[model samples]
Target: MSPSLKAATAVGVLLLATACGSSNGSGSDASGLNPPDLKAQEKLGKTEGEVNLIAWAGYVEDGANNPDVDWVSDFEKETGCQVNTKTAASSDEMVSLMKTGQYDAVSASGDASLRLIASGDAAPVNTDLTPNYADVFEGLKNKDWNTVNDVAYGVPHGRGANLLMYNTEKVKPAPTSWSAVFDKGSEYKGKVTAYDSPIYIADAALYLMATQPDLGIKNPYALDRKQFDASVALLKEQNANIGEYWSDYLKEISAFKSGDSVVGTTWQVIVNAAKAEKAPVEAVLPEEGATGWSDTWMLSAKAEHPNCAYKWMDWIISPEVNAQVAEYFGEAPSNARSCELTADKDHCATYHASDEAYWKNVHYWTTPISQCIDGRTDTQCVPYAEWVQAWTGIKG
Candidate 1:
């Protein structure tokens, strides 16, 4: 089966499971591109040491030791540092692990990075120590999650948008509005799917900001009382159309394959898997734009293997390694130079790695704190706390 078909089948299975219960767990406009220089930074130290890393389940894979894979052996062979990895299913799990000071690095998504930084469990990264830091796309450097007060904290890895993927056969003309999932009228009753996690509650808020002007929502992740109520009200309507909420990649794919769902919110990874599985799934970038998350490689503050951690970070972003990481992770690589190394030029085009036009409008995800959007401070919106409460109420 093609990866797409496999993904659709997986999503179908996930939908079935969700029918049983609730699941847990960029911008751009290159005008903002002022990436830091790494050439003047200190050179990397010695290798041949060990480093423990915590990351999402599928991130570090080697195709051996578990059939699914483990990526550390290759690093061990090259740097002589035995890589120890602990897989986590959610951001919460990653935070608790970091507090123990047992690991050296973490592959954290936007949702978890702030908690790591706020707790002082993760340290500000010394970009100088990682020679390959210069290769990161200028647009991704020093954002709200990884940098504070201009000091660097992590290396850009790869990124992708959360797309609306659907079966073209069932949904005609393709969906352009976020309302396709949010609206619960007769048109989409019991056919829509939503992301099952609490974090996705922000998506409903984003839709409200674009469609409803009176709420004056500056940031979807940051919500004031009225905006919060408005978003929760919208989600209550959305829940009526939603057939089920999904959490697993394969499960999401399965939903599309079986035609159990005609349309839903999804990731490029899930879409890629579905296409590889031969499912007739198409991913759409909506007209009003979309929200997305970017994951970064952050080093733990109390890392036991700091030198080895730096070495791995440097190696991961090198053109060759960046290409491999992007392809394996099924997303666009953040290294501008890696475009030349990609095996399929069309893949780069499809993924928007080389499209400056697309990046100009895409709003990269950030944790909603009092600061508001990464660069916008003209007005203060609500904080993540309000959004979290609204989300909880909506779920209830």
Candidate 2:
């Protein structure tokens, strides 16, 4: 992959989010949180001869980065739609790119999907129009971050967990829990790392969910000020031993390869990238479970080539392409059938793509809103804005 393009990935997409709210004037209503009422594509039209896209780096590959990784060329050939892509560096950049309406579609993660929907930048998807949608796993459908009032906004592309990756030689006994990066992070002091985003507060919250039950954090995303403060406090303490925070997966890979980062949050692709270069590294889903992302391919509200966009969505998620992208990108394919097509027969198994038991503990990213998503009506949870504010303070 090209060095610049390689910087973009689902993980760099920050696996991020917005505050989801239930109506009480500030949140949701009887129907659900209100999204800008926009019409979804009801029927297919003739291809416009081209489509433009905003996607994470590893997606929308057309062999420009690596010959073996081409997926977009065949799509253009079969659908007669030339593909133009823009690689976004962060979840915020994606949301900003989508707002321009110059692109027809984007591969959006939970963190950015809600903002797109709420802003009317992303249109609702008629999944029926995409035949391949039927093969997608049920778990990734109509999720809180991607849906509103049960309305499906996009199609699932792929998913993965933020794991505890460590240098096998430096860390002994194979730590099984997040404590390695939290409670015991001081052991590595200058070598410890964490994701460089506010959502990381949830990692601290997830650890507290298991070890500090007194904090009363039922769901990581749904935290009141007290629970939120506690999580931030833990992060502040952790910051003392922090080596650096990473938003780019490549940087994280480089850190691990150099022994500069011995333990911290990472994605499977980073582990694979480091391993390919002969780095002695391995990732584990610690006993406390973990946080994750299931990104979606959402159509633009004012898409200039709606038909081509629809065709592209269906083509990308088709089994063989999905498998190729998943293997090359290092995440689980959303299509259940794609597992059969991966070059490495163990790809899905290695990533736990179909292991429900393994995923049950994995909390997918969501925007923390004023109304608590965890069913707590008595108190308001800290919204995403506060999360941003606290994150700035934590880093300061």
Give the number of colliding residue pairs in candidate 2. 11
Residue lDDT tens for model 2, 19-40: 2221111222212246788888
Q: Per the 3 Å backbone cut-off, how many clashing residue pairs does candidate 1 have?
A: 42
Winner by lDDT: 2
In model 2, what lDDT does residue 385 have?
75
Candidate 1 residue-wise lDDT, 1-396, digit = tens: 433333244223321111000000033111121333322225556763788888665456555424423345677798988877887766767778888999988887776676677667777787877767787776677765566556666888877777788788877777777767776334767878888765576677677767888877655665555776677788877777778777766767777888878788887767877777677889887775666666778888887788888887877777776775676556778788888886666556767886756654455555555544424545554555565565557666
Q: Score candidate 1 by lDDT.
A: 0.66
What TM-score does structure 1 among the candidates reach?
0.84
